[model samples]
Target: MDAMTSKGKPSPRSSVRPLSNEQVARLGERHNLVDVTRYYPNGPRMPDAPEIGAQNPRATARLLEGVSIVMRQRSRVKAWGYDRVPTNGPFIVACTHVAMYDVFIPMMSIFHQGRRPRFMAKAEMATWPLIGRWFQLVGMQPVERGSGKALAIESESIRILASGRPLTLWPEGTLTRDPQKWPMSLKPGVGIIALEASRRLGREVPLHCSATWGAASINQWWPWPRRNVVSCFDDRLPYGDLLKDMGAWGDEPPKELVDELVRRVHLRLVALLAEIRGEEPPAEGYWDFRTMTRKPWPQDFDWRIGSSALATETPTDGVIGESGVDPGLNMVDKGAQS
Candidate 1:
C-alpha cells in the first residue's frame, strides 16, 4: 500500500530529498519497518499502516476466512494441489497476478486447506472505498510499491512469519503485462524475505509457488459464467538449502543471492503454469520486466469471451474508452516495481 500522510498524499520521501536515519528510526518503531542501512541507505521501509491480521486475534481472521469460503462458493473455483499446502507451519506463497479475480482464487484455495492468508497488497488499494476496507478487514498488508518501503514491508512480513502466519506475495509486483498471460520476471524482494525470514526463525522457510490462469475469464470482478483453474505446485522450494548452497547460514547473505532466488522461483512458476496449460512453457521462460512492453490484462476485460477487436483498435494518446482498454500502442515503460 502507498504510504499516505494525514493529507492523504504520498509520503515526503516521494520528493527528491532522501529520508534520514531519525526518520527511519521513527518508522521502525511505528510501522514495524526494518532498518537496513548497511544494505541500502535509501532502501524502502515498512509504512506505518494498519494491518488486519498483523496483531489481531484469531476471531477476526476466522471472519475473513468465512468470507473467503462464501466467495469460493459463489465463484465455483476449481483448484488443484491444495492438499500440498503445508498446514503445520508458516510458509511463503508466491502467486501470479493475472487479473483482479486472481486474488480470490488463492484465498479460497488456502482457506479451503484450513489456513488464513495475509497478502502483501498495494498501498493504493487501501484507499479504495469498499474494496480497500475489505482488504484491511482480511488482513492484507498494504505496501507502497516504489516509494521505497521494501525493507519496512519485509520487517512486517518477518513479524507475520514469526507469528506463525502464512503470507502471500505477488512477486511480479503489479498485475502481469504478459499479453499471453505468461509469468513475468520475478522480483528479488520475495527472495529477500524468504532468506531473511528463514534466518530469523533459525530454520529453512518453505517457499511454495502457485499459479492461477483463466482468471481473466472472470475478470472485472464478475464471477458468474466463468470458473478459475488454480494449480498449487506441490514442490516447495527449500529456501534453506538454497541458502546453504550459498554459505549464508545464520548471517545476511550477499546481495547476489536475490538474483538466484528470484530465478529459481520464476522458473518454478513457469513450469507450474506449463502444467496448467498442458504444454511446454516458452523457451525464454518468462518476460523480463526490464525489456518487455505489454499491457496488463484489463481489470474489466473478460478475455475468455471478450473479443480483442476492441483491444486492437488504435486510439489517440492517453485516453481510454469505456472498457479501459488503451486502444493505442499500449506499451508500458519500465517504472518502479508494481
Candidate 2:
C-alpha cells in the first residue's frame, strides 16, 4: 500500500525489499556529492508566506540563528516536500525522533519555510539553567508526564490547535529506545489531541508525518567531515474519515479509534524513514516502548489496558515505574518542542 494513500486505514506491512549493495553504494555517493553551500545559503522557500505565531520575535530569531550556525558546522541538512506542508492555519506535525539533535532539522525547516509552530516538549526542559526560559519564550508547551493530568495536557494541545497555530510533537515521547533507532510504538495522546481538536473545530486537522535520517552517524564529541542529514516532509495524512461518525460518539473518542489512528501514524513514519535510509525496516515488527522488544503490529492492543497489564504482570517491563498509567495517557513526550 502507498504510504501517502492511507484513507484512515492501517497501512499494510511493508513489502519493499532491501536495497542491493550497488544501490546502497550509489545512494551514499549521491549524498556525499551534495554541496551544503547551495542549500545552506537560505532556508527552503515555502510556496505561501509563513503564518507567524505568538512567539517572541527576537527570541525566535536568535534561537533559529544559533541553531542554524551549530547545524551548519556539524552536518549538511537537506529537506524535501516543503510544498506539502500547509502554509496557513492550524495543523499538527508528528516527527520521528532518531536523535536528540534531529529536532532542529524540522524546526529550522518549518521556520525557514514560513510558519512558526508551537511544539510540545517535556516540562522539565522549562526548568533548565538558561535555555529553559528561552525554550518557553519560543513556543515550548511543557508536557508534564505521570502527573495524572493526561486529560489536561490533551486539552492544552487541543486549545493550541483551536487557536489556529501549527503544533509539532514527537509521538514516541522520548528518544527511540528502539535498538536500531527506527520509530517505535507511539503514545496515543497525539491521536487523542488531533481527533478531539478536529471535533471541536468542526474540521479535520491536517496532520503531517516527517522523518529525518543520518544523525546517528554523527559524533558530537569530535566532529570532522560533516555528515549528510536529510528530512522528508510527507504529504498531509488524510484522516477525515475518522471524523465521519464523531457525532455518534459523545465527548471523548473511543479508545479503539484512537489506537487505530496511532497505528497509522507509526506505519507512515516507518515507511518514510525506510525511504530515507534506502533500506527495508525489520520485518519482525516495530519496537514497543513499554516492552523494550520487537513485536508484530498489535491487532487487539488497547492503550489503557496495555498500561494496566504492564503494571500488574511485568513490573520491570520498561522505563516508567509501577505507576501503570499509560504513557499515552500522561507520558506522551512532545520531543524537543522549540
Candidate 3:
C-alpha cells in the first residue's frame, strides 16, 4: 500500500481498488442475482445492446450529416477533418474524453469524415429506459465493469474487429475530466485487444487519435454552443510501433508487446492532449496513469507538449510501420460523408 503524508487533499490514486477473490465470486453471483427473468422470463431483463453507433457505418454517416447541418449554422464551433476517417475498416478511433460532449461531437466529425464509430458504454447505461435504447440504436454496448471484465471486452472487441468494422474505445476507461489539473491516466490492458487483433489478422490495425477542445458539456449542443474545435490526424500509427515508440514493458524485445503498445498509446495521448490544449503538458513524473505500467520518470524528464511544439498544421506525413502504405493524408473518400 502507498500513502502520501504531506497533504490533506484527496489522493489521486483511485479509491476504486483491486477486488478480492471472494469479491470476485460475489460479483459473478450478482451478475444475474435478481433474475428479472422470473417476471419477464421470456426475454432479457436489461434492454438489448446497441448496434447503430460507431459500428453501423450507414447510420453514423446519416447522423453525422444532420450534425453537420446544425454545426454549419453555428458560429462558435470549428470542425477539422470531416474528410479523413475511413468509410469502412477494421480500425480503432482513439478519442479524448473531457466533457460528456467529448463523444458526440467527435462521432459527428468521424461520421462526416466517413467512418462509423462503435463505443463502449457502461453496463448501467444500457439499463436506462429511453436513453438506453438510443445507445443500442447508435452502436453503444454495455461494458461489464471490473478487472475481470477486461477479458470479456477483449473477446467482444476481437469479434468486432474481425467483422472489418471500426470500434471506438476509451483507454482512459472514462473521461479525463480535469486532465490538466491532475494526471490523465488510462487503463493499460486496452493494448491486449489491439495486439491480438493485429496478430490474428496478420496486419497492424489502424489507430488514429482525434482530440477535442473548447466544448463545454455534452448536453449543450443546442443554444449558441461553446467555442470548440475537433481535430483529426491521419496518423497511421501501428499497433506494434505505437508500443515501441511509446515504450511499453518488454523482456525479450517482443514478448511484453502488449505492455509496449499500451505505453505508446499513453505517450501519444499525452502529445495529443497537449497539442489540443496548446499548452505544456504535465511533467512525466506527474503522469501517474502512464507510469502505472512502466517505470516512473525522473523529475527532469519533460512530457509537456509546449505551445512551441503544437502542430500549427496537421502532419501530412503521419505514423507508419510494416503496413504496405500509410494512409497518412487528409483524404477519406467524400462518399464516406454520404
TM-score, one value per model: 0.63, 0.75, 0.62
Candidates arranged by TM-score, highest first: 2, 1, 3
Q: Which stretches of candidate 1 lie over 4 Å from their true place?
A: 1-75, 219-224, 245-251, 293-338
The deviation in Å at residue 272 for candidate 3 is 1.7
Ranked by lDDT, the better of candidates 2 and 3 is 2
Q: Report the C-alpha lDDT of model 2 over 147-252, residue by residue, as the tens digit.
A: 4666777788899999888899888876776767778878888899889888888887877788887777676886557766777676666666688888887889
lDDT of 1 at 331: 25
Among all candidates shown, the one with the greatest TM-score: 2
The worst-scoring run of ten residues by lDDT in candidate 3 lies at: 35-44
lDDT of 1 by residue, 1-338 (tens): 23222211211212212223343343235332221111111222221112322434344445444555555554444444554555446778888876665666666556434445688888788898755776776667888766567678878988888777778988887766555566776667788788777677766666777776544554334445434344443345554445555443435555677666776676666655654544454443356565674324324423232222322234323211111222343222111111
Q: What overall lDDT goes with each candidate model?
A: 0.55, 0.67, 0.49
Which parts of model 3 have CA positions greater than 4 angstroms off? Answer: 1-75, 177-183, 216-225, 239-255, 287-338
The global Cα lDDT (0 to 1) of model 2 is 0.67
Find the candidate with the highest lDDT and give its number: 2
Rate residue 247 of model 3 by lDDT: 33
